[model samples]
Target: MDKHGAKIVSVFSCKGGVGKTTTVLNLAGIYSLMEKKVLIIDMDLNSGGIAVSLGVDATKSIFNVVDDMSNNRFNTISNYIANYNENIDVLAAPKDPRDAFKIDSKYIDLIISTAIYKYDVILIDTTHILSPITLKVLDKSDSTLFMITNDPVDLKNARSMIAIFEDTEKKNYKVVFNQSKDTGKDYFTLFDIKTIIKHNIDYTIDRSFYIKDIDKYVIDKEILTLNKHIRLIKKGDVTRLTKIAIALLDKKKNNTRSEVA
Candidate 1:
């Protein structure tokens, strides 16, 4: 509710494979360099890639904590968190997809609440599906980055989802045009994509950010932004990501002050 408390950020997409998780981790890497304590909650329960992508061997996960809470076995939140670095901590999803269903949506708020005061930023990685857990995350988020691609199907789906968000008066979201998802999928011009979606593109990830060897980064357990070569070669991309992260957090701070005034 204030500047001292952790700012919740949800990185989401109306369709999958739009660089949502990449954005989350990149932002986390930037925050780490800024000396911010970041907690990334892998909410894509069924097929989450956060732990694996980072190559973190998570022995305990979000499910364990939720189960503990549900059955009165809960204690400190640290029991379930796996440290990714000095500044970044992760709450991984269940290893088994079936376990996704066992956790209650109500526990999402509880988990976040328990960890809220301990972090400077809380980033949630979610699936495209608007499950109860995702809905709860959206409701709790201070700001959200909604990623979209240049694909026709992605635009169509985004347009509909944007319409719903506008209808509900959800003002805490920004549309991120990630052209890097597929460098060759530039079927629509900037104007055409904006016209179709009927929303202003708050940020753009140039196709130049697309790396053919991105898989290698995952294989090597590297955060793109934190990689020295990435910082030198793709410096602009990292800078833009840093700007987006700062703007998202600052926007929430400014809005909070306005409301309190």
Candidate 2:
């Protein structure tokens, strides 16, 4: 299967409030700082908030582009994109919840295909709701970051999701534990989480100063800006994000090399 010249990653979780959007924004920001052209698609159709959270104008959205495409009014996705910076662009979700109903699953394939040629990476932020659209996005993704927390409910859902992926023979996914806190409790330890989920946690973002102030930073649209005087803990968080970005790029490069061989 051709990747259409870009690495497509979908940030998804089975439970809400596990920091899916936050992870997407931070990852996009890190990639942008690395000078890679990035495009972020808000796939949380029902309650899409990427545009508002990032302070980008959302007068036009994916819904509008799909509508135009369906009517043969347009063949390109360039017009629907809002430029976020030199290296990052955003394709916002529908401004109205009612418009989300018009989005067909077929349009997602078209959007990703058109977007691949225009950007080095396409990041999709998905809702927790396991709708047809969400499943389709996961199916189309080159890599799926399965975001999860240490909570029992979240772990249970993650385990179920993993079971589905296993049954479908989908292996291009990594488990990411986010907003992890150390409460000196053995029950919620890394060992316990792995034991319950039956999968090793590939990465973890422990509680950090930056995460604590994430709400304010997102609201102010300053999430992309790294503070020069950030505390050690926050700096560690940023470093981990950078490492994650590097890991993704490395995986893509390896895949390309193997394909060539």
Candidate with the greatest lDDT versus the true structure: 1
In order, how many clashes per candidate?
A: 0, 0
Model 1, 163: alpha-carbon shift in Å? 1.1
Q: How do the residues 134-210 of candidate 1 rate in per-residue lDDT, one tens digit apiece?
A: 87787788888899999898899999988877776677888999998798887999999999999999999998898
RMSD of 2: 4.2
For candidate 2, what is the TM-score?
A: 0.90
Q: Tell me the alpha-carbon RMSD of every candidate.
A: 3.1, 4.2
What is the TM-score of each predicted model, taking all chains together?
A: 0.95, 0.90
lDDT (C-alpha, whole model) for all candidates: 0.88, 0.79
| Candidate 2 residue spans exceeding 4 A from truth | 1-4, 180-187, 224-233, 252-261
Candidate 2, poorest ten consecutive residues by summed lDDT: 252-261
